[model samples]
Target: MTPPVPPARLLVVDDDKGILPVIERVARALGFDVQFRDNGREAIDGLEELDPDVALVDLQMPGLNGLDVLRAMRDADPDCRVILMTGNPTIDTAVQAVQGGALDYLEKPFDFDRLRRLLAGVRDGIERREALLQADASVAQRVEFHGMIGRSPEMQQVFDAITRYAPHVRTVLVTGETGTGKELVAKALHAVGRRHARRFLTVNCSAVVETLFESELFGHVRGAFTGASDTKVGVFEHADGGTLFLDEVGELPLTLQPKLLRAVENGEVQRVGSLDTRKVDVSVIAATNRDLKADAGAGRFRSDLYYRLSIIEIHLPPLRDRREDIPYLTAAFVREFAARVGRPITGVTTAAELLLQRAPWPGNVRELRNVVERACILSDGRMLTDRDLASAMAISGQAAASAPPMLPFDEADDADPNLLSTVQRDQIQRVLLDTGGNKAKAARVLGVSRRSLYRWIERLHLEA
Candidate 1:
């Protein structure tokens, strides 16, 4: 049996006591759970906790008018659809309301028919958006591939290459930008290879010290060095009969490149201070974000070693290049984080999803994962909204701060510094002062990127 959907939440903010009952009656009749706020200030303060699906705000109020409330909603709960009500409507106020992100404008003496249609439309839109999220979540589960979620043509090619070469390749080089899932590709290669039952080991070439590189790659006998109290089997010997994933392989020291080349070519490794070499069968998978071909040509890396590893190569595309996969990746991350955090979050709001899709993911999949995880942790409702995502991006230092404000300012008001700009500048100044002029800290407090904060400082002509 199909379950009944929960009633949508509606918040009514109007100073007039006489109209509250009318809106409540009509809204409840249409299956809405209604809440009332007598003034815009109270409505603005309660938006985060109320998490309303729709808000009806009166344009004229004693303090904090409808436009103010609309701005608050945009910051606190961007998924809420807002309707502005005015008793004495003017062309100017109507334009301002629309520019402030109001979904619709309502005139006085309450046209019950129009109100009913507006409420019904909002409910339908919410239902459709929720249904789409569910569908995308379902597809995300189906398209996930070995800890990676992607459906774009570039990703499909990567998967195909993995499948085709995993079973046969002994030496494979994986290349891509940082955080592009090169380690996952290496693991997939090991998983699908013939040595799946054997041990799979990893070593970050960039993390190892210069002097310890040889000992880390090959075994070292006891008393081989000053502090060699006990014999140690290196990753090569430990992963014998299996696969060795050398991450950041481009950082490998030039002096040790010849030894690595010999190991990869002949499956032979000589321990430190040992005269004899031991033969071991091991599959080597090297991954690097750097251009090894260019590095070899420039004499930074060995051409022979580069050629040996590139015999079979797999490249993973960056997240931005494969943006068609963003939705699926977001859905998967939402599910994973929700389960891990014990949250009821089913998916992100449509606005939030659009923000994720439009973002320039400089850190690739890893950055997206961090953003989603942060949003899931901070989310208070079932759906993640654009406000939540923006805050997450800002904290992660990846937000597009140069983007225009959500509320469009009039051209005439631009020269005079409108209310929104004043509010923004004052807020930034206060945060900067509180943080001792630390731009990074101020950016986090303001929920903006450092680059954005710098732009704001320059545009506002602030000292710091």
Candidate 2:
């Protein structure tokens, strides 16, 4: 047999020549191919040639420092893992490095055991990413999961639900506000799962005419209707053995609900003219902005149909609610559409991000994606500027202006307060003014809501 494959490669870079040998010994002993560098800059150049599975970088270097190397490594290969070794390690610096995507940082004279563990963790992470990439390549090599991006905690929950439910060949209902990417989610559900091998169909229920609803959905025999001269197969028949996504299902006419329900329940449909009932296996995925439960309660929707369609429910939170994930999502969308539209756009600028953070994306992710796409297509270079977002932000600002001031009032404070209290009140006013005075939005930015937000605003007695 041929020689066994070598262990995974690990790159170790530092200025100290002696430390290089120690790390090499440790890494080789641990079954990793070790590469060394005398300085951070050289390490990075070597990184380009070596493509090491993981990198161990020192914090202190003459020309290019450890932190600098970490930054460069991340900029070059976002997926690369950089473990920082620092002689003068501080909590703030350590936190900054990790936040900047450095895998882990090791203090000078760090326990070799701890270093090894961190390296192993990085290796595992890289392996998992590679596996996912391989799977994607095997499928369609596209990065987007529907219109959604980011593997954050909240989005991951949505993705896991999509994966588990998409392959079942059952009806699904996705409920979310406008611009929340309900359609993208439906497409993603179709892209994978059991329906991957078959046709995936879509129709916007709200856009269809009630008069043609039956004909459009169930098809028609030749010369069966006023517009029909030839035979036509309904979406159900076309999507047989595949997925049929009904977006905005809540907007479908009340009259059409029964027929839609019948087809879903029995997997049988009758053409507008043909007397015979044809059976078709069509997996349905529905989405709506309206509250289906309330609609059912109001007798607008069939309760039985609601139960049948809601076997899998995906509720997408508004963008503002998941503000923490905005940066990642924005970056992803920028990269994607920029590449697709053949533009030079690289990413959202910091100031643009500040505007994004403050503005209310009432339209949710759909609006954000549109804004980014526009910016990407129009931008001259890699960076999306604040100017690109000016129009949207102006509209958001006008909306903010019209909305009632979200000020917190204290019942007791309204009656009376001391001079010291007034000073506290002034400070709160300043904070509110700095944060645009939208209490609910400000509260999120300040990490306080419910009781504390109003108290501070009320205490300050400011128009926040």
Q: Which candidate tops lDDT? A: 1
lDDT of 2 by residue, 125-226 (tens): 655654553344345212236666633456767887888887765887888899877887888888867878898898888888888888889999998988
Candidate 2, RMSD to the unseen true structure: 17.0
Candidate lDDT scores, in order, read 0.81, 0.71
Report the error of model 2 at residue 351, Å: 2.0
| lDDT value, residue 416 of candidate 1 | 18
TM-scores for all predictions: 0.57, 0.56
* Residue pairs whose backbone atoms clash in candidate 1: none
**In candidate 2, which residue pairs clash?**
59-66, 346-382, 425-460
Cα deviation in Å at residue 67, candidate 2?
A: 32
Regions more than 4 Å wrong, model 1: 1-142, 401-464
Per-residue lDDT of model 1, residues 82-124, tens digit only:
9999999999999998898899999998899999999999988
